[model samples]
Target: MTAAPAGRPRTARWLLRLHRPALIVWACLVVALAALLLALRGPLTDAAAEGWRQYNACQGRGRCTYDQDAILRYKDFAGYANLALNALPVLVAAWAGAALIGRELESGTARLAWTQSTSPARWLTLRLALPAAAVTVGTGLLCRLHRLAWAAGDGRIDTAKRWYDLLTFNAGGPTVAALALAGLAAGTLAALLLRRTLPALIAGAVATLGIAGAAALLMPRLWPAVTLTSALDEDYPNVDGLVVDQGLVSATGARLPIPDCDTGAGCSAAYDRAVGYFTTYHPVSHYWPLQLTTTALLLAVTGLLAAGSFLALRRLTGPLRTAGAAAGTPSTDTLAGAAA
Candidate 1:
């Protein structure tokens, strides 16, 4: 068929032409979120930090005053933005399943395309590659912006997000990008398996949620936790650290619930000296290790899903090719008939 025009430009153009609406929506969302993050990093964070400084300096001065409105506004925007970023994977999965692949399969457009100069494998590749690139770039940019916005308020604003918080952990690192890719792959897989729009969309979103939920539950255990044991009278070390578990430990090495003891003389005297507090936590240094490990696991899942999609495509096309050969013409109409 004249060598199919030599490059993937035509295929990419076709894919973009088919999915222009989704692409535009994604672009607008990215731009909006990025603008919000930029504002957070600059004006919002500054206002909140200034308010905190004022409040801290004026504490117990009887006439303390600060811009409470600015703090509230900053916190509101930060929280909403974080929520949107964390939900990006579900959005990607929905679009990938409902529009990208399922619609094509349901409407017979994919089969028609295969009847043209394209093979089922190439069609599936274009379906996945274009969306993967777009999702990766968009999500990766958002991750960087989120990290910048989050770090801008760190140590300055008292209510800034902690590293271990769910939204913060996913949004501020490579984990979001990895999740996006995984969602795309999952959606594509669901679309191929279902071959129907609505069912595929629901299945894809559910699959994405399952993957993200599991990752959230297992992330803390991926690395060895650091344990810090200290005398109950002494303050716990690294109070700002991401504490996974903390409890009181007896001299016999048995863990126990922390006693309701305060710093008062009576409480301290009643507390047993042999009962110390032990905190198992992830220090700030473990951030990259956790992020990278989770990202790797997600990317591995994406690869497996992509491979499965290709294999599914081959299985789908094998009988059509056989039928076309049997007809001796092996033309578009013959293959299209076989697909039908």
Candidate 2:
């Protein structure tokens, strides 16, 4: 068999190294999560049903049963259960980000990989794309599955599904994807700036989260997308002070009862004083636009992060001695492992 060209093979080798250490480990963990999530489906279904029953029982006595918003809050449990019970794909992704180019530079391996047939661009692309693609697919697939369950539970396709229904829900939202891309970008940026694995890892985590907050805080300001309002229209008169129009929630919740809600008084002899409250109000949202903008922004973040990583990789340099360089540490190990 003919030997492969120096370029493709060398670049492939670097990527394979990266994947073996990070992306492959991420894939394996995702498989494990998918299995676990599947395994518990029966219990979760039962729980949801039981929870519903518990709620209604409370209502019979005119008591608030489950917190109306618990449905939304509990969704995070899916992601929590996923991580608390098993390995987390995000942590693994973070670890991988911490390591990526940093470990290689730390161990002086990038020099070896780059010295061979791999040109800077090919080397960087291979190094970055394969592992990241794996991360995206692994996380994205799991998120897609999680959303499947959630969408089935809720009638409409939820655009900003909470982080916990499954970490995967976060995958669908623009902010989370942007944050994720920021994570990878932060890693590559750290790789370029720090060279040492440990510092890069720490810096990457802090920077990514910081960027996420700032982006969430500031980006929408510039983008200024039309926000959605979440009020239910009932038969209540539109008298201003008679009802308080609530601002939209950042997440979704099960329908709440207004004293005279749903334009009917089945709940109370007073024609559902609860019914009247909501009767005059309805939860309004533009599902179509919310979903479209969210999807667009998320895709944009993915592109930007990829572009950032590509640019960072193009500028990568070999490791240099830091001030008072120490040989090894636990943090360093965390940043250098295959799981990283």
Identify the candidate with maximal TM-score.
1
Tens digits of per-residue lDDT, candidate 2, 1-340, equal 3455775687577557657856566667778767645533444544554565567678658746654344443455554644432223235335645567778777876655544444445556666677666655665666555545544444221222332232333443333534455567666766666677788777777766665455434332332233223233444334321122322221233224433435555434333222223322211232223334544654565567567665665445323222224343224333244122
- Native-to-model Cα distance after best TM-score fit, residue 281 in candidate 2, in Å: 13
Task: Please give, for residues 1-340, the per-residue lDDT of candidate 1 as tens digits.
Answer: 6555655576668878966888899999999999999999999999999999999989778797899998999999999989999999999998888999999899988887766556677677777776788899999999999999999999999988897888899999999999999999888889988889999999999999999999988888888889888886776555656677877777887766655666676455435644678888888899999999999988998899889877777666664443333444356655655465
Show where candidate 2 strays beyond 4 Å: 1-14, 39-42, 58-76, 79-93, 155-178, 218-288, 291-295, 298-340
Candidate 1 all-Cα RMSD: 4.8
lDDT winner among the candidates? Answer: 1
State the TM-score for model 2: 0.58
